[model samples]
Target: MLTLNQIKNNPEELIKKLSVRNKDFSQLIHDAIKTDNKRKEIQSSLDATLEQSNKIAKSIGQLFKEGKQAEAGKAKSEAAELKEKAKELTAKLNDAKAELQTILFEIPNIPHPSVPAGKTDADNAEIRAGGTIPKLSKKVPHWELADTYDLIDFELGNKITGAGFPVYKGKGAKLQRALIAFFLDEADKAGFTEIMPPLVINEASGFGTGQLPDKEGQMYQVTEDKLFLIPTAEVPVTNLYRDVILKEDDFPIKMTAYSSCFRREAGSYGKDVRGLNRLHQFDKVEIVQIQHPDKSYETLDEMVAYVESLVQKLELPYRIVRLCGGDLGFTSALTYDFEVYSAGQDKWLEVSSVSNFETFQANRLKLRFKKVGEKQTQPAHTLNGSALALPRIVAALLENNYTEEGIKIPEVLQKFTNFDLIN
Candidate 1:
């Protein structure tokens, strides 16, 4: 959520930036300004009335102590009228504040100045590409390769649960476990503390990470309990420091977590859902960092480099793209999506997304840090990224490393998988 001061200072500038994301902020921006003005007016009135009531009550008490009964009664009547006015003004102030909060919640984070003005993914700028796409002797999609090698059981997953939930079998299950461990290990080596958070979270946690309201249809909500299954480890990991105030020395707090993410994937259908491209449930290791406002962009670059290193170690063909304004997630000021080449599928599969949310999430979470010698608390910058998501990474591994003899495991993962190849 943006501060009222920020909105007041640059309402037009912010609105123009949000317009790049296709957001219609004219009414919301106007409403927010009006609500904030009304709230301030009501608050001023309530404070004045309360002050007058307190002063009159004190005078009434003094009059009674002096045995001045007639004067005390008049003073008491005046106090009662002031009290009633204060009460009415208080209610109006509360209503205005609530309305202002509603308007603020609807306003999205302003895009980073570097964010390109565009409407879709097609407008995203490619930062760099790495490794070479392997030339397959015989083209075979990951789904076909899974069936041939008895790696994953999509049909069994359907029979047990439903579509979009596939079961990893044999080497595939072991490979998935290996990948999770590998990702956590890689993240830990890069200074991220590993955490295991609850898969279910309350509404505050959801809204704190910007997953509620807008992405309501994308999550699996437990209606009876009013909790939601987390869509990414980012939601829970970032919320760990919610409502917390840290010292300036704690500027960069990094954390990583492995979780089975749940998404409703509503309205998604057809060929796009095939194989590991899209799924209802998928395993992923996410890295989150809380940094000082000044250091956030540098930390973002470091995070992107870290993810790129992991892909390089695995020898996967990948590229980084600076997401266009409209392609960026709602809460992220800037985003870089990493896509791995899938040989058989003849496409680049998105394996990770590293984003710098700046103060947008911290403002919502009330996550702040106090500088040395400073009494005031300021919102910290928050960032998160998928070190790697499993299904598609697994898809890339199988399709890219496919050989006539077997599927050659990436060298870095061989020790974890305990076998060099799945024949």
Candidate 2:
């Protein structure tokens, strides 16, 4: 959520930057300013009414002491009327504030200046790529390999939980755990403190990370408890600092979490959602950071590079793309996507998205920081990235590393999996 000061101070510049997202928010901005003005007016009137009522009450005491009964009675009547008027004005102020908040909620974060202006993922600009795509003689998709090796039981999972929930067995489960451990270890090496957040979060937690109201439909809801199943560890991990005020010394706060994320993934179908490509429940290692707004972009670059290293270690062919405005997440000002080439699928599968939200989530979370000597506080920048999402990474690994003998595990993960190959 954008701050009122941002909207009030640079309406034109904000609108211009937001245009990169290809949506017009001019009217929404206008409505917010208008509603805020009305709210201020109501507040002023309420204050004046209370002040006048106080003066009348004070003078009424003097009047009664002076034996001016008629004048004191009239003053009491006037005070009562002012109190009623103040109540009406307070209600109007509350209504105006709600209206203003609604308008602000509808408006998305402004796109960063580097954000490309385009309509879809096709329009995204490729930044850099590493590793070579493997030319596998045997191109067995992960699902087939999972079946041939008896690693995953798709039908059993379907019978138990329905589609999009595959049961990993034997080495399949081991590989999943190995990847989670590997990613967490790498994140710890990168200076992120580990956290184990709740799998379900309350509405405030969802809103703190800009997941609620906009992406409510994509999240699994525990309606009875008014909680939501986290779509990513990013939600709970980032929300850890909600409504917190930090000192300047806390310039960069980095945290990591591995969680079983649950998403509705509503309306997904076709081959795209097959096997390990897409799932309702999946494991992921997430990295989150809270940093000073001034250095956030630099931090974003570091985060991107860190994610790139993870894929490189996995020995997967990967590319990084700068998301165009249309493809950008609602809360992200700038985002970089990491995709790995799956030999069997013969397509790049998105494995991670590193984004800098640039105080958008902070404003919503009321996450702020004060300088060493300054009294005023400012919103802190928030960022999070999938250090690695396991499903697609596993898909790409199995598909690209398949041999007649077995699927060769990356040497880096061999120590964790305790085996060099899954035959």
Candidate 3:
């Protein structure tokens, strides 16, 4: 969430930045300022009443001390009236604060200046691409390959847990484990501390990472416990620092985690969601960073490069694209998506997204850093990316690496899988 100072300093400028998201926020801005003013008024009135009441009580004590009972009684009555007024004002102030918070929640983060103005992914600008798209002798998608090799039991998964939940068997399960281990080892080599975060999170955790209220409809909720199944490791991993104040030296904090992510993926269908293209449950390795504001963009570049390296190691053909304003996530100021060419599907599949939130999430989390020798603290920038998500990466790998003999494993992962090919 944006801070009050940020909204007040240059509301017009903020409105212009937000307009790139293709919505009018002039009214929300106006309402925030207006509500803040009302809150201030109520606070002032409450303060004055409390002060006056204190003085009356002191004078009433003096009156009684002087043996003047009638004047003391009158003063007490006046004090009671002031107390009631203060109570009313206090309630109004609380209401105003709540109203202001609700308005702020409705407003999405302001897009970074580099964000291209566009309506969809089609409008996103390509940054760069790499690797060669393999010319397969047999262009078989992962699902068909899964059946041919008895690797994944889609029907068994459907019978047990419905569609979108796949049961990996034999080499398919080994491949999943190998990828997770390979990604984690690479992240560890990249100076990221590995953390095993909870698979479920509370409401505050969701809000801390800018997921709740905004994406609640797309999350699996445990209504009885008021907990939500984390849509990504990013949520619990990032929320670990909620309400924490770090020293300046804590800048460039990097952490990584491999978790089983769950998402409702509601209303998704068609060929796009087929097989391993999209899933309700999947494995992913997420990298999160909390960096000083001045160096966050640099860190974002590093993170993007790091993700690029992972796909490269997997021997997958990949491209990077800068998300346009309308396609950007609600909390991200700028984002870069990584897509791998799926030879079988004859299309590109998104395998990762690296983003810089630029204090948007920090403000909500109260995650701040204190400057050396300074009394004040300020919000730090938050960033996270999928070093690599398994399903699509698997989709691309299985499709692109298909051979007449067997599905060839990339050399980098062969050590983990303990074999070179899955036949």
Candidate 1 lDDT over 1-423, as tens digits, reads 788887889888878878878777978988999999999899988888888888888888898899999999998888888888888998898899888988888888888999988889999999999999998898799999999999999999999999999999999999999999999999999989999999999999998998876788899999999999999999999999999999999878999999999999999998788988899999999999999999999999999999999899999999999999889887889999999999999999999999999999999999999999999999999999999899999999999999999999999999899999999
Candidate 3 contains a number of clashing pairs equal to 0
lDDT for model 2, on a 0 to 1 scale?
A: 0.93
User: What is model 2's C-alpha RMSD?
Assistant: 1.9
**Per-residue C-alpha lDDT of model 2 across residues 284-318, encoded as one tens digit per residue:** 99999999999999999999999999999999999
Q: Which ten-residue region of model 3 has the weakest summed lDDT?
A: 209-218
**C-alpha RMSD of each candidate structure in angstroms:** 1.6, 1.9, 1.8
Off by over 4 Å in 3: 54-73
Q: Candidate 2: where are CA atoms >4 Å away? A: 54-74
Model 1, residue 260: distance off in Å is 0.9
lDDT of each: 0.92, 0.93, 0.93
Judge candidate 3 against the unseen true structure and give its global Cα lDDT, from 0 to 1.
Answer: 0.93
Which residue pairs clash within candidate 2?
A: none
